[model samples]
Target: MSTAQLVSLTLAMLAGAVTLLGLVIVTGRALHRRRTRRDARLAADFRPLLLELTGGDDDIDEPLRRLAALDRRRWRAVEPSAISLLTKVSGHAHAALVSLFAQRGLARAALRDLDRFGAVRRATAAHVLGLMGHTEAAPALAGLLSDRSPEVRAVAARALGQIGAAEAADPLLASLAAGGGVPFHLVAQSLIRLGPGARPALAKALYHPEAAVRAVAAEVLGLTGAVETARVLIGVLAGDPSGEVRVRTARSLGRLGTPVCLEALIHATGPAHPHAVRVEAATALGDLGSPRAVPALCDLLGDPQYHVAHNAARSLARLGSGPAMAVLAETVAERPGTTAAGHAWEALAVLDLQAGQLRRPPTAPVS
Candidate 1:
């Protein structure tokens, strides 16, 4: 080959290589510049929506929809790199959108946005989906309950609880594994929010390895009056590691008023027990108006705590059987000036059907 021909070929190859390198550098710079501009735009876009809603606009959901579409379609094309940033920005938009939908009573519209942008997997997006009560997103958000980030998992668990849909229980249940901290409280409250949806999960949670979780589960189930969960409450009355938890469980079981739980309540009233819990359980039995519990309550009439004796007297009056009446009359006669005596007078006022009234006639039940 000729020297000039070879030299021309060499220079042409090196030039092509340099040209390629220069193009890549320019592309990198373009991406950087575009990203910076897009972030600013996202913040700007979020501001108007936030201010408009907070400024008391009656409705801005329609406009928010248009704004979201601009990201999902246009900006995502010119800057395909912007999808993630845009999706996260869309979550803040949805938080505002929820209020508009509620004000307009547009359930369908709210669900649509949740089902769409909620897939972004950002904490803000999870929260928006939750506030919207999107049941369909349970499986997706449920996966976030153990997210490496506590904030993300907390939002997901909290949202599931608010959703209160049966589908969300499993994920909320999984959140119980979160050791002692804000996550535990967040998860427990969400399950409690479910009410009926939370019963089975709470019943299972009673057996959690963490005593704190188990204890909170019992109290929550009791507050929920999940009669179906009575067995768990009764079981926790004994062998539970925490005194506060057991005390609460006893009171809850007492409220259940089932004969099956009476034994547990009586057992919990031992001298070692919290006075408040023992008194509540005894009062609950008395309220149940069971003749069978008269002996135990009569025994408590002499309890060291004035409150205990008072509750015992009140329960005896409610039972209305001859033995309860006799036992109450004896206590009042024996200790007329003590606090128990004061409570005895109050008990008569409550039942209003006194020993004299019971003696006079076989009246029909009060219903």
Candidate 2:
């Protein structure tokens, strides 16, 4: 071989070896830093709020209370800590700020940092920006909806919802259009956060052929109290392929607070309704707070599924707490104390009745 060829081969091998070694070293340092950083960040972030919850930080409580009251200046005081608190992988500081960032100003700052120069920065930035409603960043975030990375796209969608851009409703609604193709949970959440702006697109989604999208649309409509969609869903309740969609329709009907919705919920609780659908339907009946739902709800006490039994029993107690207290007492007698029993007690509590202790009954008498 020529001398130049020999020299070239040797140089290539050395460069390849150097690259491999450098990658290994970088990976090791990254893993090591990650482990220690989590605890250290929490220790630093909470150093200021240590006394707020305990009521021991008299000096800090007033300021903490002021912050809790949605003070933007309070965040400026803890800005770095606030950002760290939001980005910290886990711990009490993160938990403490979950509700705080729901306020506007800090949410905007997070949106601003979403384009920060790294993955971790982007992830945390995406979370806070999507949840806090940064209207100003809507266009920039919308551009990221098509990001090559799935994580980036997902977070961008989330941030768009937080920004509550009416413009984003069309995109998110389109994602749910085919139902099977898009991520349904993320679409549902974004639609929900889009709130009033999403009502039009969500109403259209209600008629989508995809059962999942229709079901989610019904759920969002109910949550947002979209009374206008009631008539449209009623038409769908008759023959929609999925029982879940029909069940969601029943629940949304109940949310509309029309007396007609009670009948729809009653009809939906039949054997035709899936077990999970029946639970939501029954719960919707309770939210309706009508005397009419009591009998059907009472019948659900014997449902084979425990969740349905619980929801039905609770609904009956709500309508009958004053006159139906005996009925609820009887349900607890037959089934024993459970979540339904808890709701029954709470219903009684609302009726000005005292429930000092929950009672446990003897097992059924043997034949």
lDDT of 1 at 363: 29
Q: Where does the lowest 10-residue lDDT sum fall in candidate 1?
A: 78-87
Model 2 worst lDDT run, 10 consecutive residues: 50-59
Q: Can you give the lDDT of residue 56 in candidate 2?
A: 33
Model 1 per-residue lDDT tens digits across residues 1-367: 9999999999999999999999999999999899778766765655554455434455766655554445433433322222233324435444565544454333444344433433344666566567666677677677777666677777778888767787566556655655622366777688778878667767877877766667667777766777877776877877777776776677677666677887777777668777767777777777556688888887877787887888888888878759888776666667656666556666765565543453222223344
Using TM-score, give the best candidate's number.
2
TM-score of each: 0.54, 0.60
For each candidate, the alpha-carbon lDDT, in order, equals 0.66, 0.67
Error of 2 at 223 (Å): 1.5
lDDT of 2 by residue, 64-84 (tens): 555666434334445555555
Q: Pick the candidate with the highest lDDT.
A: 2
Model 1 clashes, total count: 0
